[model samples]
Target: MTGPAYAVLAGSLRARIVSGELAPGQRLPNEQELSVEFGVGRSTVREALRALASQDLIQTTRGVSGGSFVSVPTVRHLSAHLETGVALMAAAERVTVGQLMALRHLLEVPAAGEAAKHRTDEQLEDLRRAEFDPAVAVGEATYAANQDFHLVLLRATGNPLLEVITAPLFRVLATRFGRDHAPDGFWSCVADDHAELHDLVAARDADGAVTAMRRHLDHLTGAYQQMDRLSRAR
Candidate 1:
């Protein structure tokens, strides 16, 4: 199919999947059936399916009872789109990683303070577990849990808009500069910082929590800067 036709079909299919009209593991209509329904050729249906597959919304298999099936969205899929947008904004050179870190500092420091004033005991407990869980290693699982800790703080601010604004930044940071930009002990240090932040917030020491969070993020920013410098030196 042509680009516009392909887009229409892909979007329609994606809407169905997202709205739960077509669920995970559910089979999509066969190409012939879809073509007839959409009043398009089999080739058009195939092209649309290919587009959906690229977005990880569907997969195809060959054989009886095998066809296009909806696939579950994953964090990696979300992060990839965010990374692309960030890279575009960075324009390969004009926007330094330092600028991104500065933006984060500006938003997160005050948000942490607000969160301290507004957070509930349940939210703090969840953050505590995510930070101090002994079983978490320096791998994908640890990284995800760490991200969740920050997300909880953002949510605790009682500002849905702030959470939405910071979501993309977290995704970009995780995708581009996760553990690879930090030292082996970085995760452990973060765990300690998270614990302290939780304590400060739980005590309703808003200023203290804000300062702690700022210090922790500053350390992270410095680590990324060092990594950038080292890469340039190489």
Candidate 2:
């Protein structure tokens, strides 16, 4: 009739961790102590801790000096779960290339405008370092650089939530496209798009950034749709 004892304990602990009641790397009370505090058995305490650990909120150590400790949630840590979920959805065919393309346009069009407004000099330097050289052909290196530039652009929005959501979507596309060679000049065209976007971003022209981002997504949508067609024909 009621929530399980372990879930109640886990929920309480999760709330504490998120509320700063339990600081990152702070060791939790021992199982016996937790059991007494929550008025549950040792097994219930363990189950609760295990639940939090699975979510990467609490970590357990196996030595006498070790117990459950609050985990520091980094961007990478949070994005890892999203990446896994996206991959599964793609594999299950719950998501289509068309859908991914549409989602990207929705998220990234605003992201470009935001990046132009909020991006720092250091982030701009990172974009330059990514090097949108037109001479580079499509391959692993070009793919990697393109992915980096887009991820950096998302991060440049100064919006962690946007970065977390779209970075993994970028990754899902990269993984899908990485499986094959592209037509000649494919990467060069990609580089050209990045170059145009970079200049707009560096100019801090929010309107131009939005326009450029939309155009780039339009190109990418066509490319992905072509790939989908090719896959279906074979």
Candidate 3:
């Protein structure tokens, strides 16, 4: 019964917020004003604001100059939003691990090629460090270093949108998967591959970068299968 009216009101306001009409830190009209503006009751306006608040699109302040203001979500915030949703969807069997891997390949392969040409010298140095900056511990440091390598490559493409959409995949795999349990030599092999990838990027060898990235993904197939088994066990 409340869906059509209040949901519509929330959608209308959400549109304005997303379209830059509302803007970050901009205070929305008071409840009474919003109700009048949307031709709805105060309760409807309240419900709409509640919806936006739940989605992290707005925040309400309680002081003298307080009201709801547009929330400026960080990249982490946006990626976190996808994390729970995608995690739940996977749990519900609506998505498969293979499907996620495929999508990541679609995104990351091209990104590797792009990064080879676009990456700054500073980013290239970071890649070099990320490949080699692990301690003589278990695979934990190596696992972290692996994550850093992919993050740098995606960021090197200078595409914020790419990083936002794909980071959760790596996070979900690392957290719920058996990456920490990767065998002792596994980390060293990963480090070696990363070093090769670094050289490719430094050489501006786009073709070689793509080939190296694809082979690296191929090397991960067994690890991906291990994660799939772990997910089912949970």
Candidate 4:
């Protein structure tokens, strides 16, 4: 009962923050005020605040003028949480890393096919910019941009659920592998693949687009596996 109540209150507060009703950096009302406003006990408010703090959405400070305040969410925090879950799943052997990679390939291949059928010129332009920029480095920037390219593809699918599902996995993979370990030639290879995919999409060649995406994922899997092996050896 307490758990569900606390979750509800926390979710309500999170929604307010996401919706901008509680702007970032703004202090949350003190426990007494929140308890009165929510018609809940102070303990429940404290529980709810604890939940939000775990999500990196809020910070609690003590002393005079101290209270709960919204904090900017960082990708690193999100990635850390995601990596923990992925590690747990792997450790249980309920889901192997290979299985996860396969799932990604299955979803993304068809997604690329769908995108090829429905993608807009603007989305293609955005992808081109991310993939072809010569000034991008081989570390964090490259990894971030690589993730953005996939996100652009997912967005081109126009499926909100796909974005919601894949975004976390992408973040975890980026964090786990680290930017320096990402394939040095990632951008060039991905650019070539994207160009081929764009052509297939423009021509409404679903099969060709799917094939191109599969090939791209094949390269990614090989690179990731190689990096894993290197890390273990080290």
Candidate 5:
């Protein structure tokens, strides 16, 4: 049998949105108008709209001068969905820690070089704020700082798309395989690496930043692999 009528209508509307036939922020036709256009009942039109809203493809509002409109996907929205998908894949063993690290190496090393070239003064300060003294910070604070450093570094590249692509991967790795699995002194090593990376980027040393970032990721790869192994074995 075929899918429900609402699903079919939703698919048609989604195609329009994807093709840019319905531009972002462009209000959709009223339910009655949609019903007549699609040759479906008004209830089917509402259901289709609801399905689109749930997927972040459209938004609906109530009251006068309000109706459904196509959504403009933000980096945060896209990254959250990507984070969920990656987390699910990781949980199912389809994405391994090694694979995640490899992807990071591929993307972030070059991003570091770009950051060194394009980072603004404000971005450098943000990266500085992400650093912490492992001697003083422990547990969750350490993890947050480390995550922040990479996020700031990605943002410093003057490329929001890099953050859009890379932030979710960091999030999936951290959330899926808890940070508590690292060995003694791991945080300290991370602290040093982040500090060195910050300095290299601040100095606009593209080559140095690239080298430092690769080395930093290499240092953490073993810890992440250990965590993945432990998580799988359990």
Candidate 6:
């Protein structure tokens, strides 16, 4: 009943969407109806809808039967949004490099184990296709391959949540500090680790995959931390 009218309306709508009170693809009330119900102007309702749309909570359409509807978020959409948030937090120093590495260890090691246990033939083939020799692959091609390898490994776990939650952290770290500041031979080491992990997963050695992933993270975390330090010194 106080504060900015549009912001208050947006917050209420956001809570409903988050709590599933407003189901995905559910159409919202028309502008006039919302305005009357909330005791706000039509412009305020429009602004609130715009705000929700910006957050990917709702989408709008223009046709005879179209209006604003709650959004059904895909894995890629969720991951990209989270990646933006992570990048912003890192930029603000609200989250440190240490915390990110710790989270990756918590999420990815287990994900590798799961991949070993649950990976399908098609997922395994995809993982194999993601491989690249850092020696032979150059620049963005090598970087893209490394990204694909990790992404495919996560996908192999057969858990969309793992891919959604963990992919952004690696992507942010890689873009911000992981690539340019790496010491010599770092990517070569990464390629080797990926190969070892793939073999373990392909053999369905869950524990071995976990151990290999742990070791691989140990190698990567050091490089990430070193890069963080260098970035600060500049």
Give the top-scoring candidate (lDDT). Answer: 6
**Per-residue CA lDDT of candidate 1, range 1-234, in tens?**
346787888888989999999998899999988988888888888999999998888999998878999996554566566657776775566667688888889888999999999999898887776675534565677778877888889888987666655666756655554436566566677788888988888898999988998999987787777766655665
Encode model 5's per-residue lDDT on 1-234: one tens digit a residue: 259989999999899999999999999999999899879999999999999999999999999989999999898898888888888998888988889989999999999999999999998999999999988998788778888899888988888888888998888888787566777788889989988998999899999999999999998888888887777677
lDDT of residue 199 for candidate 2: 90
Off by over 4 Å in 5: none
Pitting candidate 2 against candidate 3, the one with the higher lDDT is: 2
Instruction: Please give the distance, in angstroms, between residue 2's alpha carbon in candidate 2 and its true position after superposition.
Output: 6.5
Q: Of the candidates numbered 1 and 2, which has the greater TM-score value?
A: 2
**95-200 per-residue lDDT for model 3 (tens digits):** 7767777878888888999999999999999898787643474446666777888999999999988888988887776765566555445666777789899999
Where model 6 places Cα greater than 4 Å from the true spot, the runs are none
Worst 10 contiguous positions by lDDT, candidate 1: 170-179
Give the C-alpha lDDT of model 1: 0.79
Query: How many Å off is the CA of 125 in candidate 6?
Result: 1.2
* Pairwise lDDT winner, candidates 5 and 6: 6
After superposition, the stretches of candidate 4 with alpha carbons farther than 4 Å from their true spots are: 1-40, 49-84, 87-95, 133-137, 182-187
Models 1 onward score TM values of 0.61, 0.85, 0.85, 0.65, 0.95, 0.94
Ranking by lDDT: 6, 5, 2, 3, 1, 4
Candidate 4 structure quality by residue, lDDT tens digits, 119-218: 8889888877666453555566667777887888888888756665666665655555433455567667766776777677767787898999999889
Candidate 4, overall lDDT?
0.76
In model 5, what is the error at residue 233, expressed in angstroms?
A: 4.0
Candidate 6 at residue 92, lDDT? 89
Tens-digit lDDT track of model 2 for 11-109: 999999999999999999999999999899999999999999999998899987888999977888888899899989987889988898899999999
Candidates' lDDT values, in order? 0.79, 0.86, 0.83, 0.76, 0.89, 0.91
As a TM-score, model 1 comes out at 0.61
Top TM-score hit: 5
Q: Is candidate 4 or candidate 6 better by lDDT?
A: 6
